[model samples]
Each structure stands twice: as C-alpha cells, then as structure tokens.
Target: MFDNVGYRPGRKPQNATQEAIFAFHVALRTGMRSGEVLQLGARTLDVGRRVAVVEHKTQRYTGKPRRVPLLSPAVRLLKPFAVQERIFTIDDADRDALFRKVRDRLMLKHLDFHDSRATALTHMSRKVPVQVLSRISGHKDIRILVNRYYRESAEDIAKRFA
Candidate 1:
C-alpha cells in the first residue's frame, strides 16, 4: 500500500507556490493523520524542543499523547504561520481540496496526501529508535508500521542490525 511515495503534494491554492510548500512540508515532518494534523494546536509545538506533542487519532480513547520530533526545515517553514490556536488556517475540507488539486495537476495515480504519513515514516525509520518511532508514528506494533511503510533492502536492514 505504501508503494510509489516519491512525489510530495504541495499545498498550493490556485497554483501558488509558497503556501502549498509549507503545508506539504508540515505533513512530511509530522507523519500525523489528516484529522490530527488539521486540529493540531499551537500549544502542541515546543519550539525549544523542536517537537510537537500530539494526541494520536487512536489515542483519543487511551488519552496519552506522543512526542513527535520535528525536522529543522519543517520548523522554519511553520514558524511564520504558527498562531495561538492552530498551525494551519485551513480546515479539513480545504486541506482535502488543496491536496486533491495538487495530486490531479501532478497526474499522480493513487498518491493521496495521506500517503505523506508513509513518506515521513520511511524517512524517519532509517535513523530513529524503534521506541521513539513507535511513539511518533503512534503505532503500537512496530512490525505493522515497518512492514507497511518501509520497504528497505535486506542489506540495508542487515546493516542497521550490524
């Protein structure tokens, strides 16, 4: 399901470059679900720690929040837009529309914005510790998370183990 993950959907409105890039950059760093990221409040970000404290979509029932580390690039991209209540001004409908327009324009097949989660996971799994990755990804089972998101070569995995 996580195949063909190269193209990241930019958050363009009417083909504008800057806004779209920022939106895409945020999704790329967080690995959060659309609902979770859309509702992510400003308080979630700890600038000093460069981390976003998120309550996983699945964790609404469990009530434990996870600490997701942010890339410096994403922090820079978000800093200008960060507000008192939310990081993104757009709602879910706007997010969906923006992502859909970008996907259609790029002519990508089956590449939904949600796939950005896999993109983030694949990027982080290579370097992040399993425990931390599980927390950030909000996946209680690392096997499912790794199997679904990461398609590493046997040699690459072997090197990781070594």
Candidate 2:
C-alpha cells in the first residue's frame, strides 16, 4: 500500500495519509506489528546502535525485551521522528480504519494490517539465518517463525536452486 497513490516516501509527512504511510514503512522495515509501530516513541529508538528495543506482544510470556535491528533504510525513515514523543500519532483503531479504507480503495481487501510483520520477516529471511530472524522477530520457537512467517514461494525457492 506504500506504493499506492497517496504515499510520498523519503519526505516528511505533511498530512494524515502521509503519516499513516510513514507508519507502515516503519512496520515494513522493522518487522514490528502495527500496534508496535503506532506506539513507537522516541525513547524506544537507539539510533546510534541502529536498533529499537520495544515491548511486544510476546514480552509477557518470555520476560525478555524485543530488540529490533534497524537497517539503514529504516533508520533514514525514522530519523525525522526521533525527537517526537510518539512517532505516529494515530491509535490502533484509527490506524485500522485508515488501512481499511486504503485496502478497500486499492482492491486489497485480503491484506491485513498485521501482514506487514510477516512480509518483513519473509524478506529478511533471505538475508539472515533462521536463528537470527527468530531473534529479530522475538519468536522463541523457530517452528513458529518457519511455519507461520517465512512465506517464500515455491517458485522463489526453485530459483535459488537454479
């Protein structure tokens, strides 16, 4: 949806649509859930270290903080918002409503807001080992990572062999 009509990448957001687009880009880059991205605050980001330590959904179960490695691309996108208390001002309900309208307009009704995490992990899986990906995703079970989020197509897999 970032490529859709309203999104303007690389520029500071000027309006609500641009802000939502920016949030989605953060989620895509950091492999963070929509709520996590919306809740992201300046305090959570460690730009010097290129990582963001976030309190995630699984934090209560594992009793460990989630450390999300921020690649250069993600850092660039996040730099402008580093001084703000909250990166994206929209709440989950608003974010959901925005995404719903975008998806409906874009004919992407099948897309879910949470799909960004899965998509990010799938792309990251190609560059990092499963163990590393597991760490980034905060998934204690490798099986969950493999079974649920690592969604490389069979055609893509065959291309690797070829």
Candidate 3:
C-alpha cells in the first residue's frame, strides 16, 4: 500500500540529490517529524530489530522514547547509507527546501513535509490499534490521538454501521 517509488530499488530523481529524496522517504516511512528526522543519527537505527529509536521531539509530553518499526522498503533504503554517522546531516532549512522543491516539481498538490507524519499515522490507524498507534505516534494520551491525529477516519464506525 505504500507508494515507495523513490525508496525501493529505484532510480534517483534527476534534479534532486539522493539525500534530498532520502530525507523525505524516511519521513514518510518512519512517521518522524521533519525536525526529528533531521536529527536522526545513524546509530539510532537497529537493523536487527528493524526499528528506529526516535529522539522523540515530544518527549517532554510523553516522557518516553518511541521505537518505530521499519518495513523492508525503509530498511533497504537505509542499509547503504547506514554507515553515515548522522543518518541525516542536512539542516532544518535545507531539509525543508529539498522536500518542498521535490513536492512542487512532482506536482504533488498541497503536500508539505509535516503531512508525511500525519499520513503515516492515518494509514497506520487502520492497521494498528489505538493503544499501539499511541506508542508509535508518541501521543501523550489516547484522547489527544483520537481528538487530533487521525480524527477524520474511523474505520470501525464505518464497518459497524455498514
């Protein structure tokens, strides 16, 4: 279900650098905020476990770190670049620029970097139960999740009524 064109054994974009595409794909797959994705050091990834230990940006709210599982596409994209000390070395400003530039060039309407995280949570909400998604998304409380994240979609309600 993941549209992993750039991340999975595909050619790099002509105008964009590999790093640019990589940052965006990682954001998409990991559900990491652009800032946290920028801060990721290579060591945070556990290849054996297929999880990334996020330096949770919302740690002050959640008071715990989060471990996000990586599917094969993400892991494949990571393996080659795994040697870099800082998984992503680009600064916040440049990171945003690259993501925006690619989004525009591809004509992906109304897309922004932060949408990647929201997209991830929305998709996962269907597959992962709220309790598990709370941990994955680092939501401080279930109410915060149901009240804010993925509020538009209620799969169970649809199924029940139908």
Candidate 4:
C-alpha cells in the first residue's frame, strides 16, 4: 500500500525522478492515462494551440487520436522536462517501478498506476458534466466514466440531501 510503503519522505527527486514526477503530475492534472502520457512526443504537443494529441493504448474503441487541452499547471510542469523526441518515455516495467517509487515517496496507500487517471477523471467530473468529462478523457462510453472513474462519497450524498 502507498501509505505503508515509505521509500522517500520529504525529499525531492533527483534527475530522472523529477522527470517522472512531472510526467505523473501532467497525467494527474490532465485526466490522461499513464500510457498516454508516456507515449507523448515533442510533436504531439502544440503549445501555440494549447492542445496535446494523445494516442490511446487501446485503439479499439476511441480510434487513434484524442486532443487534450493543456492546463497551465500541466504545461508548466512538462515544459522544462520536454525532450526533442519524446516528452516521456519509459518501458512498462520502468513505468510501474517509477509509479511505485512515487507512491512510496508520497506515503499514499492503495494507489496503483492507473489510479492517476481515475483520480484526474474524478476531480474533473466535479466541475464538469459526465459527457464533457468523458470527452476530455477520451472515453466513448459514459458508463465507463461513471461506473469506474467517478467515486462518490457518503459525505457528498449527505451534503446534497441536506
């Protein structure tokens, strides 16, 4: 679990870790899957247009391209780390290792790599409609977004009813 696994605490990441953190933050803020974020290339980001084209891992449903509007936070985090060829590139094993390291460092429990996408979707859904959120997240089916990504709490329900 994340809270129990203490790899590093209150310490900044070194060279590679910093880049990994930047990539993770971009995925977190932009509602992008880890694979999508990792697949990003320099040509994928159009800063003048403020849009990023992400190629989904599973192209069976959503096709090849999904445009994501870059938030200022995501842009700022990624700008310095961007490379000429790829924004972020790590093999599946390395990606998982990096996520584990980040989870341990942050003292987060039960957080998996895919959880970042869910977290981003949940956060975005609070401010946007399910349809809009689905579009932004490149989910063709709203059911996937609602059933899997959005986590509603008892406190929220009670507040709504109150």
TM-score list, all predictions = 0.73, 0.89, 0.73, 0.76
Clashes of each: 2, 0, 0, 4
> What is the C-alpha lDDT profile of model 4 across 27-89, one tens digit per residue?
787888777787766778776666788777667665667788776766665565444467555
Better of 2 and 4 by lDDT: 2
Candidate 1 local lDDT, 1-162, one digit each (tens): 111223233322223332333455578887777766665557887766777777666677778777777777667655554544775667667767766766676677688777888888878878787777777777888898878876567897898789
Q: List pairs with backbone clashes in candidate 1.
A: 11-20, 12-20
As for lDDT, the candidate ahead, 2 or 3, is 2
Model 1, runs deviating above 4 Å = 1-21, 155-162
Task: Tell me each candidate's RMSD, in Å, in order.
Answer: 5.5, 1.8, 4.1, 4.4
User: On residues 1-162, what C-alpha lDDT tens digit does candidate 3 reach at each position?
Assistant: 113224433433333344566777777776777776766667777766787776666677767677777767677766665556776656778877876766777788598777777777777787778898887776757887776657444675598469
**lDDT score of residue 69 within candidate 1:** 71
Q: lDDT of model 3 at residue 151?
A: 44
Q: What is the TM-score of candidate 2?
A: 0.89
Alpha carbon lDDT at 68, candidate 3: 74
Evaluate all candidate structures by whole-model CA lDDT and list the values in order: 0.66, 0.80, 0.68, 0.69
lDDT tens digits by residue: candidate 2, 45-130: 88888888787787788797788888788898888777778777777788788777887898988988778889999999989999
Q: What lDDT does candidate 4 reach at residue 105? A: 71
Give the Å shift of residue 50 in candidate 4: 2.1
Which regions of candidate 2 deviate over 4 angstroms? Answer: 2-5
What ordering of candidates by TM-score runs from best to worst?
Answer: 2, 4, 3, 1
